[model samples]
Target: MSAPPRVPRTRPEPVAPDPAVPEPAVPEPTLSELAVSEPAAAEALDAHEEHAWSRCDPWSAALRSGRGPLYLHREDGTRHPLDIERWCAAPDAADRTVIERCRGSVLDIGCGPGRFLVALAERRLTALGIDANPHAVARAVRAGGGALCRSVFAPLPGTGSWHTALLVDGNIGIGGDPPRLLRRTAELVRPGGTLLVETAAHALDERLSVRVGDGRGVHGTAFPWARLGSTALLRHAEETGAWAKAGEWEAGGRRFVALRRA
Candidate 1:
């Protein structure tokens, strides 16, 4: 018989908030409220203070279990499975390609569980993993990688000095505004530094409100996300005037683009 999949022997302890991204003084709606609230109302929450990103939300639970029956349910009734298995596993061939191309101090935005950070550390490379999910950050640290429970829009260490910034694993869709995210990333990367992005497999460019849902029909807060193909990503980069496409390639059926800060 095949060996059973390994599971965590114990529950992860609560993680402390990273000092780098302090909580705001204002009160905010709970994540549960955001789940049933209008998307427009949830959108009003500060990017740095989105409860779904910080609390023990569905994403965090899935990460803790090292598996998933998770899906991103779009407002239009479309659903996309989040590949939690692949995310929790070691870096695959496609991930390796990105790792090889990384240069200088690396910043991994929305780095869930720090698989890349672990891989980068194996190569003795300087890298830091940042995520809003506290559980994911704890997992990354326990796996012997450096991570911070912080959001990209919040204050971060080494602003405008990171040699490379990464947006992979569908993180390009973060906040549902590709152009604005691209522009913000430019501000984080040093002049002439690089931004490596992974795009969708096929031709696609869209922005939509989505929620984290499980097979049991439970749903979490709604948040904005975007999907972009290489063409669309390049176009956004061009429009921002902060990056130029250095190259594009495909591996393991995934497409990626490398952009140099202009």
Candidate 2:
């Protein structure tokens, strides 16, 4: 009887995969890749000097009292008073003179609270300030200036396109290596661009491990810093291969040197 009328056979429904199971794993990063991926962590480890600038309100005495007696202690057992007030103030006559020399787009390295940047903007110049401290950058932006929170050693915007790079307010001490710093600055500016640098009034060239200390026996970690005089800066300019001493001037009892790329 045709097997009692062929029973209709139906195919079984396809089983759906489990949703909770994870997809195939991604290969973990190698050691070198890990190091490269987390560059900010490495930078944070070496940024001991940033403690003061990162945490303290260097502008207001009421705020500074909480982070008191900040001074730069040198390896040679000397100390230099860090004048936070002056750095936070408006550009003085000397600073204005330096600003006048800025011909085109300006990059102010270590631009503390950005008084210079504000001044340049007021004059309708294309200017940008960079500082390692977020607080400083915020203050600058709040004051209607353009600023970025970054170290000069870090990759910057518009490298080799800037017409002027400033190392004012003793920022030449960055990394405590003047020749290296000058070389880097040369790379940042276009050919024939200018670098306006502030130098120590005295004829001294020093590389020191410096730490900030509060008079109340509290101190931050130490980092390399440098101090150079006009003569020493000129020598450094010669060593940097592309820089030449263009001129020198004095402002507000501070000495500055102008270097032009050859």
Candidate 3:
């Protein structure tokens, strides 16, 4: 018999905060401890237990320069351009839709450069942004928004109590496993709280091993990522049984889905 196919290994990026500037303190949970019920996921995570920072240097360069010619280069050679400029800019129409829908305390997961955090603060809403890139966190702080260098799977402050958790800008693909991410988000949100996720405009449910590339041939560390459209997202949410679809809409060519925690 043929050997089983190897599962793609993806270790969480653990970026240390800049020593020049202090960041808020939050306890971190071991990667080994998450999703223990899912043996395959746990095994995959454990496989890379000692890997260091996810070499986001190429991505860091783009954020530091406040622009992008960056793209996600898949193993198959398909490249998806990343909107670094928009993420560095002020919130646009689609972002406004998300900002307006936010309530109570908010957690911006994988918040790149903190545009949404700043927007939320401008409205006087309590918010915090967490990212696994030290550069992104530093940029966010410089932009006058609260941010921490951390992963979503790590233990965060006020776990199980946030009013809203955001997975915008294709962040839902962070772990390359949508169902696992959905389940983790459910742990972070309060009962009946909401999860606002951005999805692809068309039907798409794909997992890819990719690296951040400058489009000039430079690439960063390879990581597993996934993408989901509204249909795929709804299906995963139902399967998790931890979320119920509350609403779905499109603005500025971006699709969003609102999920109420069950």
Candidate 4:
């Protein structure tokens, strides 16, 4: 009888539900997906160590003296001198020639310090310069030119709409893949648009993984780069099927090729 009474008085306690587990975080947008303008996006990706040459202060003595000790250490154990002075200097006769060739909306790939871009702007041409080096971009902006710290391989503002595209300052060696770079330029330039590229004077086509060095201790990370002569550039253009040789010229001991869409 007492057990029965106790059971009747007893009541079960309520149990609390476990807090719901939070869902996994969503992944951030990629560089392409951001769809941001070149300048803004470029600033986000800017890294000083990635492009040591942009910082001209450390190399001021060498750059100003036109005797830069900067070099590119190739995989073959050879060191190729990099012309930091020319790149940092104002536009010369040869640079003017390249600028004169630029017509309609111009897109300068690897536009170091924006010398050509500034010239284009002075002429009132719709021009945009893109470089991966923030310091270079800053210099360009300071000079009152439109420039962005961005890579040519990244998403651009006017893909396939640019009337003229440039790959000067040995930028044809970019990424160490001439064919790929040519194909990319083709994609960037519209039908009948022109692609002006600078090449080595010799007839060699070589690709090497290299790093930038000041010969004083400062060095950058290794990157793939190529050096193609006029002949090799023409061959690459033919293989791409997106371009045809329009003209060729030499300036300041450097060679250049002009290609137009088929």
lDDT of 1 by residue, 1-262 (tens): 2211222222222223323332323222221221221112123235534755444256767988888898999888889999888988899999999999886667899888889988876665567776766677678878866666656776566667777799999999987899988998998888878899999988899988888887678777787789999999999999999999999999999999999997
Candidate 1 vs candidate 2: the lDDT winner is 1
TM-score to true structure, per model: 0.81, 0.76, 0.81, 0.76
Number of clashing pairs per prediction, in order? 0, 0, 0, 0
For 66-122, candidate 3 gives per-residue lDDT tens digits of 888999988989999999999999999889999989876678998989999888877
- Clash pairs, model 3 backbone: none
TM-score of predicted model 4? 0.76
Residues 1-262 of candidate 2: C-alpha lDDT, one tens digit per residue? 0111111111112222223322212221121221122123124322534443443333223122323345777667777887666666788898888988986667898887778977877675667776665556556666666666566766666777677899988899987788878988887787878899999999999888876665555555566788899999998889878999888999779899999977
List pairs with backbone clashes in candidate 4.
none
User: Which of the two candidates, 2 or 4, achieves a greater lDDT against the reference?
Assistant: 4
Per residue, candidate 4 scores C-alpha lDDT tens digits across 48-81 of 2233333334333343344577888876778888
Candidate 4 lDDT at 149 equals 60
- Each model's RMSD to truth, in Å? 10.7, 20.5, 10.1, 20.6
Runs in model 2 deviating more than 4 A are 1-69
lDDT, candidates in the order shown: 0.75, 0.67, 0.76, 0.69
> Which pairs clash inside model 1?
none
